[model samples]
Target: MDTTLRHGPFVMQLGSMPVQNILVDKEWNIKQFIEVQSICSLPIELMLPPSWITGKDIDKLLSTEDDRLQICYRQFAHTLRHEEAKRPLLPNGRLHSDTLIDGLHSSKFWLLQALQSSGNPLHTFRRVKGYGDNYAGKGKPLAAAAFRPQIYDYLKYKIASYVDYRKDVQKLFNGEYGRVYDEEDLDYIRRRPIVPERK
Candidate 1:
C-alpha cells in the first residue's frame, strides 16, 4: 500500500491512514498547534497554553509590567482575540451558521475529541446568541445562543469520559460526521451525561 504522495507543497496524501495512526492527543502537540496559528482565535485556544505549557507560562508571555506572571488577565485575554472575535453581537443578535462552523473547526482536535465520545460539538455553535439583521443562525433552529462555553462544555463532557474513548472514535475519524449526525441525530449527545453517573 502506497502511504506517501507529495504534491507541490500543500498536498501530501497519506492514503488510507489507519484510525489510531491519526487522532492523537499530547500536551506538547496542542501547544505547538497554537503556536503554529493552526488553532487560532477560539475560546479553548486560550486554554491550550496552560494545558500544554503552564498557565503561568501564558501569563508570563502576555504580561507587560516587569514581565511578571504574578497576575495579568487582561493582556493574557487579549492574546486570544482574533480580530473579528470580539465583535459585538449585531444590533439585534445572531451568529452565522457558517461562522459557527468556522469556530468549531478552528478547534479541530477539540471537535475530533468531542466526537470520540458522546458529545456533538458542532451543534453547540447554535448557543452563540444569534441576533440582529439577517442573523444567519436564525432559520437554522439547530444552533443555540452562540455561546462559546456551550462548545467547550460539549468537549469537556467527552473528555470527562476519559476512562477510555468510545470505540465510535473510529467511525468519527472516518470523516462521515455530517452523515452520522444528520438533522435527526443532532441532539442525541446532549442528553448523555457529561460525567458518568456515580456508581
Candidate 2:
C-alpha cells in the first residue's frame, strides 16, 4: 500500500490486489511470459484467488543472496535479451501478448542451433528433476514427468552476476513490444524499488 515508489507517473508496487487482477494484467503477464515461458500451465481457475500466488510466492523461489527476486528478474529479462540478440523477430512479426509454453523445446533447440552454428561453444545446461513421472513409463521415477526450471534460473543468476540486467529489462519493456507498455511504464518497472523479502 506504499505509494512512495513511482511506476510511470504513478507510484505503485504489487500491493494486495486480487491475484487474478494482477495475473491477467497484460503488462505483468507478458513480463512473466517473456521470462519463464511454459513453466506455468495453471488454468485460469487456478490462476485466481483461493489458490492464487503473489509476489511473495515468487520470492520464495528466489533466495540467492539479499536481493533474490530482483536478481532473478534481472536474469530472466537478460535471457530474453540473449534470444533477441539471435532472432530479433517473433515468427509473426509481432510480439506475442501471451506466449503459451507450447513449442518451448523446439524454440530452445533452434535457438541452440543458431548459436552453435555461429560458433558459440556447446553450452550444456545442467539437468533438472522432472515434476512428475508421466515420462517414467519404464519404471522410471514419476519425477521424470517434468523437470525443474533450475537451468534457466541458474543461467539468469550466472549472467546477471556478470553483466548489467537493467539495460536488458529496458530493452524488453521499452523495445518493440506491441502496446503492452510505453517507455514511461517500462521506466517505472525498471526504477521501482525492490520489495524486501518477507521475514
> Which one wins on TM-score?
2
Instruction: Give model 1's clash tally.
Output: 19
Error of 1 at 193 (Å): 40
Compared with the true structure, model 2 gives a TM-score of 0.17
lDDT of 2 by residue, 19-123 (tens): 434334545443222222223332221111111122443223332432543344445445655665666423434221122121122233222222223232122
lDDT of 2: 0.34
lDDT of 1 by residue, 12-34 (tens): 22222222333345742422122
lDDT values of the candidates? 0.33, 0.34
Q: Could you tell me how far off, in angstroms, the CA of residue 39 lies in candidate 1 after the best superposition?
A: 9.6
Best by lDDT: 2
Candidate 1's TM-score reads 0.15
In candidate 2, where is summed lDDT lowest over 10 consecutive residues?
A: 43-52
